[model samples]
Structures are given as structure tokens and as C-alpha cells.
Target chain A: MKKRAVAYLFILPAALVLGIFMFYPLAYSFMISFTQWDLSATRTYVGLSNYRALIVSPDFWNSVLYTVYYVLGVLPVSLVIGLGLALLLRDSSMRGVGFFRTIYFMPVVTSPIAAAMGFSWIFHTQLGYANHLIDSFGGEPVNWLTNYNGIFQLLFDRFGVELPRVLQGPSVALTVIILLGIWQNIGYATVVYLAGLQGIPQTYYEAARIDGANWGKSFRRITLPLLSPTTLFLLVMFTILSFQVFGPVQVMTPQGGPLQTTSVIVFRLYQQAFAFYRFGYASAMAFLAFSMILIITLMQLKYIERRVHYD
Target chain B: MTKRHVTLAIKYAVLAAGAIIMLFPFYWALSTSFKELRDIYFEPYGMFPTNPTFSNYISVFSKAPFGRYLLNSLVVAAGTTFLQLVTACLSAYAFARMRFRGREIIFFLFLATMMIPQQILMIPQYLVVMRLGMGDTYQGLILPYAATAVSIFFLRQFFRTIPKDFEDAAIIDGCGPLRILRYVFIPLSKPALATISIFVFMWSWNNYFWPLLIVDSTEMRTIQLGLALFRTEGGIQWGEFMAGTVISTLPILILYFIAQKQFVKGITLTGMKG
Candidate 1:
């Protein structure tokens, strides 16, 4: 009885803090989602109207679409490149391996706002290094951030191809933000993949070599299968992270970029809640985004975990 | 050269190219920060600053309350980290060792909080803090993050791995539960404590959204919010902006360089478990 009482005493502080902050606020947020509050003295309960409006709102859908584009753009490219880097640097005994790892991981440690600032300077249209490089090569200076045209449309323009609006890819501005995401994420994925690579048994590789398997054959037969768990982990993590990307979008393209092409879900939520003082509407949007993330995570676990090879 | 040597050379070459690409942004930011406005705008810009000056760095401090921003960030981050450590240590000790009612269920509840996205909680949390009259206060900034599921979960796993013999010996010496935690578990789990400390400190330092929502005055702005707001207000002053970025990043970068192994291990530990 004394021990159990002590245990309760031990948990008291944490329980108080978590209960007051996380658990209570979560319930309060849910309750607020059902109301119309504008930071005023009173909140009038409206009963799902906020959610219904979000479901039919074009701006809400646009943010979701752009978020999906950002996720798709960042995830696969970073995974493949990260994996490749991991493979290249797998031999820890090799000279400069640590040096290379440190360089790659620097951006991961870098705050997103700082990274965005660096990228903004790099891609600045007139007075930027990117344009300087283009001018040096006798090419036209690309409007990297200001251009509202989707990258697909921009690419197809040279071929006299008019891509439909829906078929058009992420706007050039949003693509810049996506590029930043990929740049920061590649290092994290690389490090995680490196750890995964370390767990593979050397005997497995020796056996493959003895069986007359080449590098490509060994990679496909051994490496890919062995790294599936790591891949899934990275996939879930990157998806959750990419969906909530706001700092860079806000820093790089302040007003959600040209035509609001870069206004991701969190950015929209922030604007609704703070800028427009539509707390109820923003809470509804938050729940919707949260549900979407939950569903995707569950779906990934259910379907993707089946294929994950665990030793 | 032989095929083996050629392949080695190619490998090094590729790694070198990748390193250059990775380091270029930092290099550019550093390089631009030192340049005069004339040098920045001059046609046929030099790769490195021809006439490097400290004017931008000086102006960054002069033009805004950047020093105060750094202080605010330090206070909030340190305070939050200290509080998180205390709360996490206590709860994790209980979850790891003590026999209590509903222990498993409570542990699961703590784990469930990890999945609740901050976006969902931010609105009401803002309201709660404001209602409590902590708006724009350090406590408002620090207390909400005083307990995190990540730290508690992490410390619990570490504490579970500790040998039972230590606790038994401590108890034999007439140490109570609190004393055992302080004298035995904490002292023994120095590495684990350090890992969590660095992780929490870095997280608090880099946090932008919470501070943005809570901070209303120039005096309370963190380095992140200060830098961001500076970008908008000090439009097109790229030199000053880069200077601000370098200053804000320097502390974390210095910490990373000093504790590179801990940073990597912390990431792997949290990344794998969480």
C-alpha cells in the first residue's frame, strides 16, 4: 500500500501537467470545433457547420491538394537519394565517411526558418546566385518563387502543350518549398538508412557473393528486403512531417505564395484561427487534417506493414 | 589506374560533389553576410566577398531587439528543458519500476498523447493559457511543454534497462524512492539524461509556431520569431537577414558540433521508438 502510494506520488506532477495541458486542451479543442468563436466573450455552438463549410470550401481543398503535391514531391526523391547516399557511405571504415555524414546531416540540425532564409536568398529572382549562374550560362533568369505557373505547365510550354489546370503540377513557388523539404529530409533519411544498413549481416552478403550474385543482384535480393522496415518508418515519419510543413512556407512565400499555391493545410489553419479570428473554423480544419493524417498512418500500417520484412 | 582504384576514385568524387552541394547554402549565407550592399548588388558578383564587413552583423543587433530575442529564447528553452526533465524523470521512474494501479493503462495513455498532432491542440491550448492569464509570459511559453510524451517515453525505456541490484542496494542503504532516483538512477543514467536534455533544448530553441501564437510584444519574441518578423519588416535587407540567420543558428550548430554523437544517437533513439 505504501509502495503504491509512492508510485502515485511519483506520477503526480506529470499527470497534473499532461492532464491540464494535453488531455484537457484536446477535449476543449473538440468542443470548440463545434462552435463559432471569434476570440470574443461568447462562443455560440453551431453544430458541424464549420466542418460542412470546410468540406465544400475550394480554398480548403486547394490547401489539401498542394499539401499532397508537396508530400509526393519530397518523399520518393528523398528516399531514393537518401538510400543511395547510405549505400555509398555504408563502409564506416572508409576514410572521410564521418566527414560526409556530418555535412549531410547539418541541414537536419538547421532550424527550418534559417534554412528557408538561405533558400530564399539562393533562389531570389534578380539578386540571387541562381540567377547569376543562369546569366553566366547565357540562359534566362527563372522566376523561381514568384511564378504561379505549375512546373508541368512551365515545362510543357516549350513543346506548345497546354496542360489542363488540374493536370498541372505544383506551382514553381511551391516546388521551391518542396525542394527545401527534400534537401532537409534527405540527410535524416540517409542517417536512418545508414543505421538500418548496419544491422544487415555480413554473412548474408558473403553468401550472395558465393552464389555468384553481383552488386545490383545483391542489392535487390538482400538490401531492399532487409531495409523495408526502415523504409516504412521513414515513410510514416516523412508523411506526418511533410503534411505539417508551415515554417518554410511562411518564411519563403509569406502570403502563401502567388495565387495561394503554397498555402499548406497548417498555413490555412493558422490564417483562419489567428488572422481571420475564426477559431471554430480553424479547429474544424485542424480536426479534419488530424483525421486525414490518422487515416493515412493507419492505412500505411495496415497495408505497408504486411510487406515490411522484420528479422 | 586499375579498375579497383578507378572505382574508389569515382566513389570519393561522388561523395565530394554531394558534400559540396550540402555545404553550399551555409557557405553562401556566411559569404553574403560579410559582403557590403554594393558588393551584393554589383554585377559579376565575386564568389567570395571582396570587401568583407561586419556592418550587417552590427546592424542586425542595432536595428532590432535581437539580443533580447536571444535571451528570451534561452530563458524559455532552458526553463522548459529543466521542467521536462523533472516531470519526465518522476513519471518515467514510476512507469519503469513502481507497482501502481492502472500503470499499464496510464502508460498507454501517455503514449497516445504522442500521436495527437500539435495543430489539433494549439488553438485550445492558446486559449487555455490566455485564460489562465499567462499570455505573453514565460510560464505560458514553458509550462505547456513542461511534460512531453517523447521525453517520458524515452526515459522510461532507459530506466527499465537499469539493473535491479542498484535499486535494491540503494533501498538497503535506507534511501527512499526519491533518493534512489536521484542518487542511483539519475547518476547512473547520465548519458540518457544528457540525450534527453539536448533533444528538448534543441526542440524548444527551434520551436516557432507556439511562440508566434503566444508572443505579442517585441520583448517576448524568440530568436525564430524575431528572425522571421525581421525578414518581413526589414524587407530586401538580405545581408542583415542572413546575418540574423547565422546568429540564430550558431548556438545550435555549436552544440551539435560539440555533442555530435549525442545528437545522432538521440535522433536514432527517438526516431526508432517514436
Candidate 2:
């Protein structure tokens, strides 16, 4: 009994903090999702109304679409680039690999707000280096962040082929944010993948080489399968994280860009709650976003847990 | 050179190109921060500043309480880190070493909190903080984050790896459970402790959304919030904006560079475990 008392004491402070902040807030948020409160009045219970409104609202749905687009745009590109960088740098004979690794990981350590400012300046239409580079190359300056044209649509139009609006793909504004997302995350994925690659034993590669396998063959036969677990982990992590994209949008395009194209789910939640003061409605939106993330993560974990080889 | 050596050279070239792409923004930010407004307008893409000046940084300090924001950030971050370490150490020890009723369930519940994204908790937490009159207060920011699930999980994992013999030896020396934790576990888990400290400190220092919600007054604003205010308050003043960014980023950059290895280890440790 005394030993049990001591153990409980050890966990007391943590439990207190968690209870007050995490558990209580979560429960409170869920309850608030069903009520109508405008920060100045008594809460009036309107069960399912907030969720129903969120479901039917075009703004809410557009934010959802934007969130999905962001995940799709950022996740795979980051994974491929990260893996490629990891492969290039995994060679111990590369003398300056450590220096490059540190350089690459610099943005990962820096605050997103700061990184977003840099991106905002770099993609600034009037004074941006991007436009300068284009102008120097004898091409017209592109409205990188403000242009709402779909990149593919623009490319097809250049060749005199017009595509439908639905098939136009991600907007130019969203693409800039997507590119920033890739830049911010690729270094982290590369570092993790590099660690994963280092953990793979050398004998497999050497044996493959002895058996007349080329670089490509050995990579396909040995490296790909060995790195699948890391890849899956990165895929799920990046998916969840991309869903929470806010800082860049908040900093770069405070008004959600030309047509509200970059108003991702979390950013929308922030706007609705803080900007519009629709706390109850925003709470509902928050719950829905949370549900989607929880469901996706749980489903992925269940499906991928068996495939991830510990060794 | 042989074909193999040529391929190695190509690899280095590729890595170097990627490094430049990764680092160009920092280069540009630094250049813009130091360049005069005329230089900025004339050569936005210049490799080097033609005329370097500290006027932008000077304006940043004169415009806002940037130094006060930095001090507030330092206090919140250090306080949060310190409290998190104490709580995480105690709780993780109990979860890892002690055998009691509801241990597994309690630990599982704590672990489950990691799955709940902060977005979902933001509104309610803001309300609770406001209701409790802790809005714009240090305790509101520090106390909530002091029981971080990631830190506790990390510390617990580390504690489980410490051999039983060390604790057995400590017990033989008439040390109580607290003493055993203090004398035996903590000293051995220095690396893990340092890892969590850096993680928590950096996180608190760079926090945006929570601080944005909680802080309404200029005196209570964090460095990140201050930077956000700078962005909006100044109208397209790229030099001072970038200068403020440099100020916000430099301290974390220096801390990261000084403890680069430990930071990498901490990230990889969590990354691989996940």
C-alpha cells in the first residue's frame, strides 16, 4: 500500500497537468462543438447544428479540399527528394556530406514563421529573386504567389491545349506553399532516411555486387525493400503534419491568397475562431479535422504495423 | 578517373547543388537584412551586399519591445523546460520502474494524448485559460506544456533501458525511491534529459499559435508573436522584416549549431522509434 502510494505520488504532477490542460480541454472542446457561444453570451445547446452547418458550408468544404491538395502535393515529393538526398549522402566517401547535411537541416531547426518570411520574400512578385532569375533568363516574370492559375493548365496553354478547370490541378499560389512545405520537410526526411540507410548492413550490398548486380539493381533489390519501413513511417508522419499546415499560409498569404486557395483546414479554423469569433463553429470544425486525422492515422497504423520490419 | 570515381563525383555534385538550394534562402535573408533599401531595390538577387548596414536591426529594436519579447520567451521556455523535466522524470520513473494498480492503463492513456493534435485543443484551452484569468500570463503558457506526453514517453523509454543492478546498488545504500531516482537514474540518463530539454526549450521558444491566442498585450508577446506583429505593422519593409527574422532565428540557430550532434541524435532517436 505504501509503495503504491509512492508510485502514485511520482505520477501526481504529470497527471495534474495533463488533466487540467489536455484531457479537460479535449472534453471541453467536444462539448463546445455542440453549443452556440459567441464569447459574450451564455452557451445555448444546438446539438448537431454546428456539425451540420460545417458539413454543408462551402468554405468548410473548400478548406478540406485545400488540405487534401496540400497533403498530396507535399508528401510524395518530400519523400522522393528526401530519399534521393539520403542515398546521395549515405556514401561515407563523400567528404563534404556532413557539411551539406547540416546546411540542409538548417531550415528544419529554424522557426516556421522565419522560414515563411524567407519564402514570402523569395516568391514576392515585384522584388523576388524568382522573378529576377526568370527575367535574367529572358522569360516573363511569373506571379508566383498571387497567380491563381493552375501550373499544368499554364503549361498546357503554352502548347495551345486548354484543360478543364477541374482538371487544372493545384493553383499557383498553393504550389508556392507546397514547394515551401517540401523544402521545410525534405531535410528531416533525408536525415531520418539516412539513418535508416546506415542501419542496413553492408554485406547485402557487397553480396549483390559480387553476384554481378549493378548500382541500380542493387538499389532496387536491396535498398528499396530495406527502406520500406522508413518510407511508410515518413509517409504517415508527413500526411498528418501536412494536414496541420498553417504557419506558411498565415505568414505568406494572410488572406488565404487570391481566391482563398491556400486556406488550409487549420488556417481556416484559426480564422473562424479568432478572426470571425465563431468559436462554437470553429470548435466543430476542429473536431472534424481531428476525427479525420485520427481515423487516417489509426487506419494506416493498423494496415502498416505488420509490414514494418524492426530489423 | 574510373567509372566508379566519376559516379562518386557526380554524387558530390548533386549533393552540393541540393545544399545550395537548401541554403540560398538563409543567404538571401542575411543579405537583405544587412543591405540598404537602395541596394535591396537595385540588386535583390545579389550574392553579396554592396553596402551593409545595421539600420534594419536598429529599427526593429526601436519599433517594438523586441528585447522584452526575447526575455519573456526565454523565461517561458526555460520555465517550461525545467518543469517538464521534473514532471517527466518523476512520472516516467514511476511508469517504467514501479509496479502498481492502473499502471498500464494510466501509461496507455498518457501515450494516447500524443495522438490528439493541438488544433483540436486550441479553442478550449484558450477558453479555459481565459476563464481562469491566466490569459497573457506566463503560467498559462508554461503550465500546460509542462506535462508533455512526448517528453514523458521519451524519458520512460530511457528509464526502462537502465539496468536493474544500478537501482539495486542504490537501494542497498539506504536510499529511498526518490533518492534512487535522483542518484541513480538521472545521472545515467543525462543524454535523454538533455535531448528533452533542448526539444522542450526550442519548442516553447518557437511556439506561435498558442502564444498568438494567449497574448494580447505587447508586454506578454513572445519573440515569434513579435515577429508576426512586425510583419503586419511594417508595410513591405523587407529589410527590417528580414532583420527581425534574423533576430528571432539567430539564437535558436546558435543553440542548434553548438549542440548539433545532440539535436541530430534526439531527432533520429524519436524518428526511428516512431
Q: Point to the candidate with the largest TM-score.
A: 1
Put down candidate 1 lDDT per residue, A1-311, tens digits, no spaces: 89899999888888888888899999999999999999888989999999999999999999999999999999999999999999999998899999999989888888899999999999999888888888889999999999889999988999999998767999999999999998888888999999999999999999999999999999999999999999999999999988999999999999999999999999999999999999999999999988999999999989999999997
Which regions of candidate 2 are displaced past 4 Å? Answer: A159-166, A302-311, B271-274
Per-residue lDDT over A98-168 for candidate 2, one digit per residue giving the tens place of the 0 to 100 score: 88888888877788888889988998898999888889899999888888877789889878988985567
DockQ for each model: 0.66, 0.66
Cα error, candidate 1, residue A61 (Å): 0.5
Give the residue spans of candidate 1 off by over 4 A.
Answer: B272-274
Note the Cα lDDT for every prediction shown: 0.91, 0.88
Tens digits of per-residue lDDT for model 2, B1-274: 9988898888888888888899988988998999889988887778787888999989889988899989999999999999999999999999999999999999999988888888999998898888989999999888889887889999999999999999999888888999999999999999999998887787788888899999989999999888987788845489988998899999988998998877777666655211
* Candidate 2 chain B lowest-lDDT run of ten: B265-274
